[model samples]
Target: MKVLLVTQYFSPENFKSNDIAFELAKRGYDIDVLTGIPNYPEGKYYKGFGLFRKRVEKINGVRVYRSFQFSRGQNKQWRLALNYLSFAFFASIWALFLSLFKHYDCVIVHAPSPIIQALPGILVKKIQRIPLYLWVLDLWPEAMQSGGGIQNKRILTTIENIVKFIYTNSTNILISSEEFRIPILKKGNYNEKIEYFPNWSEDLLFMRQDFDIPALPKGFIIMLAGNLGKSQDLDAVLKAAMEMKNSNNIKWVLIGDGSKKSWIDDAIVKKDLQDNVFTLGRFPFEYMPTFFKSADALLITLSGEYPDLKLVVPARLQSYMAAGRPVLAMIDGAGADLIHKANCGYSVKSGDYISLARIIRDKVFSDLETFEKLGLNGRKYFEKHFQKNKCINHLCKIIDSK
Candidate 1:
């Protein structure tokens, strides 16, 4: 089967779409990607890519069609909006032109952000009368509101309308978390079309690795890897570190980069947490498994201020589980429930630094055997639910259906 995968980010930039496309290709599917220039977490364009450059290239046997889009410069709201809209406009035009000559069995839109990315997929589906599958990784206006991106009621309503249109036009919707279903259903009359499709860890890069990285600290490491952003409520983490200053055996390691890194850096110095907390800037995706293996526990957090955040199951959760480490989550709703259900570790309400510190000091640091058992449970849960092959096979079934 030939499938057109649409996303704003692709290979060499680190996104789930890369793994999904490759896995499908290995399964004997002809996959073509429609994406923008590779500029993600870092707002600038990647080296060798520019405003007008190679529009098409084959990466690892998958044909990728690149479109013109602005960079998300340093969290500037206007730049980010332009980046999102430009990709929608250019990708739709590019896909429309391509549709006149080539044919695809279906178009799968991987929506991690800027739900507007679905615009081109909708256009292709309308023009070619092929199935349009939307895989929603993040909820709209809610995420924006939580991030303090959009405050004006008019803008929020407009975005809501766009979201409704995208959901209404899609042939099927795949939600990453079970909690996303009801919220999406509230946006459009596609309840029957929506299916729960949780994301799997990037098994190729996120498995147990034997290599030793010298930078990893010796003490009980509580590591938080992935985008370090305001939404993560890292302020609470810093507060927890402050409260646990006496607990010298435990150390906190934060990996990855985002808009909030500067704030975290300042907090580390101001709060005098240099010894208890360590910040290892972003590393390549291949190095993640080694970092995970080196850590005793993985931390996942989301801001309590955003109620919608409760519905989110951060992508790193699966990676942590796949690495066979106990999870320590300061998140609520679906994310917390998943950890509890898996019996993988402990979870506290978002921003509850007191409880977070207590858990680490009492349960995690004191009981090594229980911590190991929790890690084992997480690995078992990952195998049963979040394995890449199983999830991809389920995705194939969905694509082949109807």
Candidate 2:
């Protein structure tokens, strides 16, 4: 079958869409990816990728059609909005043009942020009379309000309408979190249209990748990897580190880069957490296990303001599980439920740095045996539920079903 997979981010951008396209290709399906030039959390074009450059190519057996998108410079709110709209506008142009010659059986949209990327798939579906599967990793206006700190009801309502339109046009709605189902149904024409589909861990995560270790502290490291963004509540995470700054044994490390990098840098100096905290910027996804190897515990955080955010499970959690590391979460709802279900590690309520610091001191610090046990439990849970092939096979089954 010929599939047009659409996303604002793809392979070189370090998104799971790359995996989906490649896996489908491996299954003998012809996959074409419609995506923007690779600029993401860093908000700059990746090396060798730029506007009107590398617009057509093959990557991992999938033909890629890159759009001329505005790079999200430093991801300021206005710039982010432009970045999202540019992809929708340019990619829809591609959709309309490609429809004349590319006879795709269906369209699949991988939505991380700016689910607006699905605009092209909707256009393609309408033009080709084919189904559009919207795999939503983040819920829309809710995420914006909670993560972006957008409180203007007018703005949120507009975004909500856009989300509804996207969801309404999607033939199948696949969610990364079960908690997302109810909220999405209220806006979309969803009646058995939504399916609870979770993200899978990368195969490389299960196998250790050999690499030189970065300058991580030689102590009990509590590491947080992935986007350093507002939604991650890194400020509060740093506050927790401050609460335990005198502990001397536990260290806090942040991996990955985003708009929040400067904020985190300022906070580190202001909070006097220089010795207790370290920030190692972005690296390839394959190097995760190597970074994780030095981590005594993996940390994941979510801000508490938006109830919608509670529905999120932070995709990095699956990689942490696959690495067999004990997780330290400052979150609530489905994400916390998953941690509890797997018996992975202890969690404090979102925004509760006091309890989080207490847990780090009382539970997660220097207890090698307990860490090993919790890590083992998490690894076993990942093997059972999130193996790459198993999750993708289920997705294919869903796609092939009536």
Candidate 3:
């Protein structure tokens, strides 16, 4: 079967769609990815990739068709919107012609930011007369209002309409969490075909490694990695850091780059937390497991403003669990529910730093045996639920059953 996977952001950019498409390719499906140049989160064009209407490359046996569009970082809201719209505009024209000439059996779209790529995706679906599957990582408008730092209600309403249109038109909807399915059902008349297929991290590299890195203080390290954008309340973690600053053993490391990096840097200096808090900017994805396994606890935070956000789990959550690390979450809704059910981690009040600090202190310092058990439990949970082949198999089943 030939599957055309569409996403605005893709691999070499660290988006989940890249991993999904690669897995499908491994299953003997002919995979073609329609994506823009590798620019995301930071929005700068990647090295060696020129600004052009189209480019092509083969990475890990998957044929990737890279189109060109204006790129801008997420720090500027208007430019970010333009970047998404520009890609949608140019990529749609590119795909309409591409699909007219080529035959594809299925069209799978990774809906991380829906408004950005929905036009091209839906247009291709209609033009090709193929089964369209919207694999949503984040809900639109709600995610924008909550995460994208968007406040314009009229624009939000428009995006919601587009979301409804896509949901109603698609043959199937694949959501990463069960919490995500409810909203789609509420918005459209397609509950029967809405399927929850959680994302799986590439466990081969993320799984605990035997490498012996130098140990830190006697207590455990509570680490948070990835983009610290508006949706994530990293200030809560910094607050937790301030409270635990005096502890010699408990160290807090915040890694990755985002608009909030400068804010976090300023806050660290203001709090006089230079010793207890460390911010490592943007390490390569390959090195993630080194830090994941080295830490005693992995930290996740979700801002409390968007109640609808409960429908999704951040993809990084899987990586930490895959590395056999215990998780500590300052999150609510779906992620919190998963942690509770798996019994792999403790959850503090969403955006509550005081409670998070106390929990970290207790978990990282109090009981070594329990900490080890929690870490193992997380690995077991990954093995049972989120292994990569399992997700790929489920996706194939959905396509075949349809």
Candidate 4:
């Protein structure tokens, strides 16, 4: 079978979209990925990527097509708007041209945010009339309000209308979280078209890499890996760390960089959390497993108390489990439930720093063997449910049946 994968971000940007494309190609399916320039997580363009440079390449049997897009600069709201709008416009034109030459069985879109990324696939579905499967990783206007803090109802309503249109057009809607179903239904009046399809750990995280890193301190390492953005709720985690500052042997290691890095740096100095909290900065995606292996437990947190916001799932949850470590979640809804259901580790309500601090000081400090057991449970759960091969097979089944 042949597939046309549409996404705003792709390889070199370090998203699961890369895995979906390359792995499918390796499994004997023809795949072509249409994406914008590699600029994500960080607002600027990656080192070697430019408008005309590396526009088309075939990587590991998968053909990739790049479209012109404005690089997100400094992450101002306006810059983000340009980044989304530019790709939606340019990639659609690229798709139209590509369709005249090549043919595919269907189009599958890996949509993270700005669901507008799927417009190219929608265009193809309209023209050639092929199946358009939308893998919805992030809920729209609601997420904008919760994560981006855009309170203007007018702006949200406009985005809401777009979300409905995208949902209405897709041949099938695949949601990353079960909690997202109701919102999709309300937005597009979706019926039998929507299905639950959660994310898995990046395939590389399960591989054993011989990379070495500087030694962590002589203490228990509780780590958080991924974007240090506002939605991560790191500020509350910092406050929780303050309560446990006296525990010299327990260190909070944060691994990743984002919009909140500078703010976190300032807070570390101001709050005198230098001893307990350590930011190791950003590293390559290949090194994630090594860093995760160094941690005694992996921490994942989300910022909001809103019901819909709590339902949002972060992709790192599977990566942490793939590292074969105990999970610590400072979140509610789907994420917190996953932790409890898997019996992987402890969880506290979102925004409850006091409870979070207590859980850290009490549970982590009590019995080390318990964590080992919990870690084993998590790894077992990951292999059963969220392992790459297993999830990829599940993904193919969904696409084939559709």
Name the best candidate (by lDDT).
Answer: 1
TM-score of 2: 0.96
lDDT for residue 387 in candidate 4, whole number 0-100: 79
Ranking by lDDT: 1, 2, 4, 3
Query: Where does model 3 exceed 4 Å of error?
Result: 204-219, 362-364
Q: How close is every model to the real structure, measured as TM-score?
A: 0.97, 0.96, 0.94, 0.97
| lDDT agreement of model 2 with the native | 0.87
List model 1 lDDT by residue over 210-246, tens digit each. 6555577678789999999889999999988888887
**Candidate 2 deviates by what RMSD?**
1.6
Error of 1 at 189 (Å): 2.1
Clashing pairs in 4: none
How many clashes (backbone N, Cα, C below 3 Å) per candidate?
0, 0, 0, 0
lDDT of 4 by residue, 67-99 (tens): 999988774988888999999999999999878
lDDT of each: 0.89, 0.87, 0.80, 0.85
lDDT of 2 by residue, 129-154 (tens): 99899999988888787767788999
